[model samples]
Target: MPDYYISQISHTDKTVIQGVTALLNAEGIRLDANLDYTCGMYDDEMNIIATGSCFGNTLRCLAVSSEHQGEGLMNQIISHLIEVQFERGNTHLFLYTKCSSAKFFGDLGFYEIARIDEQIVFMENRRTGFKNYLKKLEESSALQLQTLTKDTSANTATLQSDNALPDTSTADRKIAALVMNANPFTLGHQYLVEKAARENDLLHLFIVSEDASLVPFKVRKQLVMEGTAHLDNICYHDSGPYIISNATFPSYFQKDENAVIESHAMLDLTVFTEIAQTLGINRRYVGEEPTSLVTGIYNNIMSEKLPENGIECIIVPRKTDGKKAISASTVRQAIKDNDVDTLKKLVPESTLRYFESKEAKEVIERIRNSGNVIHY
Candidate 1:
């Protein structure tokens, strides 16, 4: 065995943490900004030659020096981290590593979850890591459905609770899916849905059901359902915290541009593709974003990575409305600026009626008081 000892390093251990970070940084690794726990392999000289960390069951920032390669130190470091997670009642573990080193980890029983390119691959242990997550989500969804059904009579005017997708499968039809957050749905949103509906035999429109957006989830879903009612073959589904949310891809919301979009994108797309396979969706469609940097990066990631898994990615250009591109952000800006003419042009008739309703009066006033807006 090498003359080394592994030890836990607290976040406050600045000096020792710096030593480990130096090793990882020199190896060109992206550091996790937050860590629940960390472990380091120190040489007899007390230098951190290897280091690894765990962030919410995901093992991250594992690096072994080139000089120590082939010495079985990587396995040692990983075993320590996995045990750390195991002790915390987390049997399933996930990790991100380069594609080249994947085989090394694979030998240790970590299977590939998703890969962004030759440079990056996300892997998880085979012990119900992903399967458990799906089960938990389904249970939560079922409970919510029961609650909604029970309260429908009480809040008929306030709550519109009938958004459920058909699970009926048809192997002969070419099923396509479009995941979106039509926050107070706009004409551009309608155009994309219409295009996908026109091209595919069946289109699954998954409105991002996460309530993290500025617009409430109830309002957003209602707008989308009302606006797209014209499409007969389109089915409405909920995103269920699987796409572009803290549960999957949190970096999509953070302002830090230095964060790696690759890992977040891969992790989210991995879960999405699983659901896609279950639904027999072979095509994924997205609107070409010209303004939002974060959204654009996500679109590019899907375009590149989805194809590897046999899903065709279609990037549709935004539909223009004579003066400007018809977008949800444009609609929001119009609401903020009290530009009725622009809002009327940008949004669908359903969205317009919603804006006029007494139920929407508070949201409109809030938007008016809000500052200059940029959707990312």
Candidate 2:
């Protein structure tokens, strides 16, 4: 019954930002660092009672004052954020909310995608968004299988040999997957893909499609495909919004140090279970990342969680170029320093060629202008 109004909270307005941060803190929430837009609801007395934020298509760091509980202020905030998102052309919206608060958002038309026990819940506006994603994966897998079968038959017929084709039977076939950012598609990536392709009947390669890295997603994907073109067992899949990349993961969503890391890994792996099932994936391969704390934590979480879902998680040791282990971050640093020799040692020829092309001129400039390129 109390009068209330919502307004956009400018990041530059330190006074109002402090008020919003105080309210969120009182509610045991932290201000998310990755937000592009934020808004706060004010009562008649100009007190900040509720707040919400938008990062890309995600609604994050939402909170309401304890005194305003059940006053329908959050509904107003959500509506305001939705309108803002619509204006921004982000129709398919996503959000992260506490598990206990999920039902309230559900009533507002957000469907749950995945959760990490009682810590956090990942939701989206569309009811069938995740289902449709899985269906697309299944369809893509089937199409690729058909093409591979045809190619195998043609090769066998041309050779006129009884043993030209390998066993394509489902019983003995090994289907595995690898999800990679492939920011530059280094030789290390090629090494992992080569090993996986050699050992598996089919490899579902999911390229992180989020454009958050120094190298854009389009270039990353092109380099990945071009670098692995020799491998015949690969079925490439754009991660879309389903697969969470480092860029898309909201690291600042949770206040607890370990919970932040665990929540991200758990939510991602939970969604991946369904994807793995759809593609008949029994194993996942990841390159060893011994330096980055976030990635180390994620790999550990994957090792524990994937096995519970009957999927094996394999961490392949990083491939070395005689001196140091090859990494995208290292290659990025090389690009920044214009170290052509280091670049040659780290990335595949296809990836190296891409960076040297006229098409990569802007991207090279972008990388060179960046302050830091190393992941750690």
Candidate 3:
């Protein structure tokens, strides 16, 4: 056993970073280039022995050299990444790892959220996220649920309940749902909502409650509410931390991490499926995305997973302006380039009204200055 030290790596440390990638690749784990921060452990010989990377609060690409395995190097790397995230102001954390490494992290206080069989597993440091969120949501509807708690070994979690329970039934309405970011509430969003609302007796429009977008959740929610004011059957609600949240939305830095996109989508869709059953929602409508990489993958996942979970996912063709699809990204780009004519066509008139207001003027300015915005 030789002395080992761990430290953060920079772009200049290309050799060490490459070594880290090699170590991970050798272990059948692909290095996610989308990592915002990276760190590595070095032996006394200055040889990289272990490494890991962090994408916001979600840790990824963690690996240890074969020679260094079983020496607890993986724990050290995970600890470093967790501390980095904490210093960067992230309290909750998510990690995706190969099935074999699940227990290694599970011992470090990570709890399983979802798993793709033997392929991959998504875990969170906060064991109660889904249970707590579900409890809160069901509580809002006055429905009681048994809460889940981490087991004593921290190896797994189990569900628990008090002696009391709320009514577990909901109205048997012909209900559907749609989750949207509505970054600026474009007409495409309005069209999708209208179609869903027309067919279903009630439509639950979930706005991504995380302020993870260029536009804050409050402003985005307001625009969505105003734009859909005509839909009497539609109900707008915040997505909260459970659905498409920081834990699951993987386009962490305005770019796609293609490898983990589906994994992230699974966690979101899983929670959504649970919520659907609770609200008597049978179908979910989403505008087909033709441009954005992240949302397109999410829609595809919705098409595949939701039905299997007993929820129908309807992918509506996005409303097009001539040959082009209307998108929040297009609206943001138009605003950035000051293309008023094109921006007006993409977004609804109500959304445009906000673009002219003093408050939105500032938002638009920040958006224009911000580089590479993700369209939820």
- Find the candidate with the highest TM-score and give its number: 2
Clashing pairs in 2: none
Off by over 4 Å in 3: 141-171, 210-212, 232-235, 245-267, 290-301, 370-376
The order of the candidates by TM-score, greatest first, is 2, 3, 1
List model 3 lDDT by residue over 164-183, tens digit each.
Answer: 12122445545788888777
Model 2, total clashes: 0
**Native-vs-model 2 lDDT?**
0.87
- Predictions: Cα RMSD each: 8.3, 2.3, 9.7
Q: What is the lDDT of residue 60 in candidate 1?
A: 80
- What is the model-wide C-alpha lDDT for candidate 3? 0.74
The TM-score measured for candidate 2 stands at: 0.95
Q: Of 1 and 2, which scores higher on TM-score?
A: 2
What is the per-residue lDDT of model 2 for residues 1-376, given as tens digits with 9 covering 90 to 100?
Answer: 9878889989999999999889988988888768899999988889999999999999988899998898888889999999999999999999888889999999999999998888888899999999999998899887987776677775656323321224656465678899999888999999999998877778999999888889999999999999998777789999999898766677555767577777888989999998988877899998887877888999999999899999989999999999878888889988998999989999888998898899999999999999988875
**Model 2 stretches astray by more than 4 angstroms:** 157-168
User: How much lDDT does each candidate structure score?
Assistant: 0.75, 0.87, 0.74
